[model samples]
Target: HMTVISAREELVAFYERRGYRRTGVLTPFPYDDERFGLPQRPGLAFELLIKPLV
Candidate 1:
């Protein structure tokens, strides 16, 4: 499983078309942590995506 930024719907769709599906799980962006740089906008989150092998 991997995560993509919630705001990037186009990327999500691109993965989905290749067999990846949404996990319906959302993770909050590390706003307090600057190791990942700063967000361009507010309310940024990550949506989990997975490709089941089983």
Candidate 2:
């Protein structure tokens, strides 16, 4: 399992190419916290991605 910033469509596609699929889980990005990053806009979040093994 991994997380990708929802805004980064390219990354999502990259991961998708690697067999990772969106879990439809959204986590609120830590705004105002440098630990995550400085959000230039509101409503940003981390989207969960998962890859299943055979």
- lDDT per residue for candidate 2 within 1-54, as digits (tens), equals 999898999999999999999998999998868987677888889999999997
Off by over 4 Å in 2: none
Give the lowest summed-lDDT range of ten residues in model 2.
32-41
* TM-scores, all models, native as reference: 0.89, 0.88
Candidate 1 structure, TM-score to reference? 0.89
lDDT tens digits by residue: candidate 1, 22-51: 988999999999897988999999999999
Residue 17 of model 1, lDDT score: 96
Kindly give the stretch of ten consecutive residues in candidate 1 with the minimal lDDT sum. 32-41
| Clashing pairs for predicted structure model 2, backbone only | none
